[model samples]
Each structure stands twice: as structure tokens, then as C-alpha cells.
Target: MAEFVEVAKTSEIPAGGAKVVEVNGKKIAIFHVDGEFYAIDDTCSHEDASLAAGTVDGTEVMCPLHGARFDLKTGKNLSLPAVFPVQSYALKIENGVIYIQV
Candidate 1:
């Protein structure tokens, strides 16, 4: 069974924006792109930085610390310095509220 926790409302994050939320003591970054929502581990795999603070270009997020890029849809490390993909969480939106499966 999966447990879903409400993280934020749709209005909290605008299109092409992101926010960091803590669920079950784990930090997760939620991104809004083209009216869709995606969630992933907030920490950068290459360094100790917040992915939520990184620059988002389409579905790719560049790590602020090392310029490593990651695919928001698949959590794939799309650049150097970050060989490991960050953990991507399941997300759902219901009635304007965003839920994350932890």
C-alpha cells in the first residue's frame, strides 16, 4: 500500500515554478511545468544543494552547486558530476491539492 500526503495547493506553485516540502521528515521538491506537477528528492546528487533552488528549464533542473542537470520527469542525471539519479516520488493532484506518495 502507498501513503499519500498532501503537500501543497496548486496555487502555491505557479507554472514553471517549484517549491520544497517536507513529508515524513524527507525533503521533496515539487515542480510545476506547463500546468503539471512533479516531485523529486530536493538534494542534489552531486553536492549538498537544494534542487528546488536550481534553475528549471523545461523538464530539466540544473544543480546550483555544480551545474549538474537532472530530468524532472524521470529523475535522470542528465549531466556530469551527478551520476546517480535522484529519487522521484509519485504525485497526484486532486481538487487543486497536491499529494505525494511517500
Candidate 2:
């Protein structure tokens, strides 16, 4: 089973925003959407764009480089220019702390 690692505090991510955290040498993107948290790989499938620097709207995250849209909740690629789906990690919030299963 994957172990949960404390990535960041709940207050670190603003509303409709995302933050990148390195856990076990892996880059993970933590997103805050509508008061909920979602974790996914920071690297974009297409090119080398950072999803953490992209725009966050609800559960969707758009790539800042080529406007590739991805669903943060399911790691699904919604638009073109990005054929491969980004990896997604499990997220848990406890006592105002954000934990990710890595």
C-alpha cells in the first residue's frame, strides 16, 4: 500500500490555486478547488510544462505552456495538445494538514 506523506498545510494553497511539493523525490501538485484538495503529478504529459503553474478552475487544471486542460480529480486529459493523462495521487486532509499517498 502507498504511504501517506504530509505534503503541505491546508492554508498553504489558496482558493482555486495549486502548489508543488516534492515527496520521496517525486514532484506532486496539490490543488485547491472549491474548498476541496486534489493531488496530481506536477509534470505535464505534453512538453515540459509545470501543472502547478497552470490555472485551476474547479477540478480542472490548464497547462500554462500550451493550454492543455486536465481534470485534477481524475487525471483525465480534457483537451487536445495533451494526449497522455497526467498521473494522479491520493489526497487526504486531516487537522488542517494535507497528506498525499505516494
Candidate 3:
């Protein structure tokens, strides 16, 4: 069983914003939407673009390099140029801080 690791504080990510943190050498993207938090692999499935830098609309994130859309909650590829889905990480919040199961 993997233990959850501290990533960032809730205040570090504003609503409709995201930030990337490395865990076990893997980059994980943490998103804040509508007072909720989500975690996913930072790299876009379509390419090497960073999803944390991509634009977010609702629960979806559009890859900045190739314009591919991915679901932030499930890491599902939702549009063209991407046939694969990225990995989604389990997240927990305690005392305004974010932790991820990596």
C-alpha cells in the first residue's frame, strides 16, 4: 500500500488553478476547481506538454502543445490528438494541505 505524501498547501492552488509537484520522481499535477481538488499526471497524453500549464475548463484540461483535452478527475483523454489517458492520483486534504497517494 502506498502512503499519501504531502504535496502542497490548499492556498498554493487557487480556484480554477493547478500546480505540479514531483513525487517519487514522477510529476503530478494538482488542480483546484469549484472548491474541490484533483490530482493527475502532469504530462499530457498526446505529447510531452505539461498539463499543469494547460488551460482548465470545468473538469477538463486542454494540452497547451497539441490542444488535447483530458479529464482532470480521471485522467481520461477526451479529445483529438490523444489516444491514451494519463494516470490519476488519489488525493487527500487535511488542515488546508494537499496529500497524494503515489
> TM-score for all predictions?
0.96, 0.95, 0.97
Q: Give the TM-score of candidate 3.
A: 0.97
How accurate locally, in lDDT, is each candidate?
0.94, 0.90, 0.94
Ranking by TM-score: 3, 1, 2
Candidate 2 residue lDDT tens string, 1-102 = 789988899999998888999987878899988888999889999999899999877789999999999999888999989999988988888999999988
Candidate achieving higher lDDT, 2 or 3: 3
**Model 1: per-residue lDDT, tens digit, 1-102?**
889999999999999889999988889999999888999999998889999999999999999899999999889999999999999988999999999998
**Candidate 2 TM-score over all chains jointly:** 0.95
10 residues in a row with least lDDT, candidate 2? 54-63
Error of 1 at 28 (Å): 0.3
2-69: candidate 3 lDDT, tens digit per residue: 89999999999999999999998999999999999999999887778999999999999999998999
Model 3, total clashes:
0
lDDT of 2 at 15: 88
Candidate 2 residue runs with Cα over 4 Å from true position: none
Instruction: Give the Cα error of residue 90 in candidate 3, in Å.
Output: 0.9
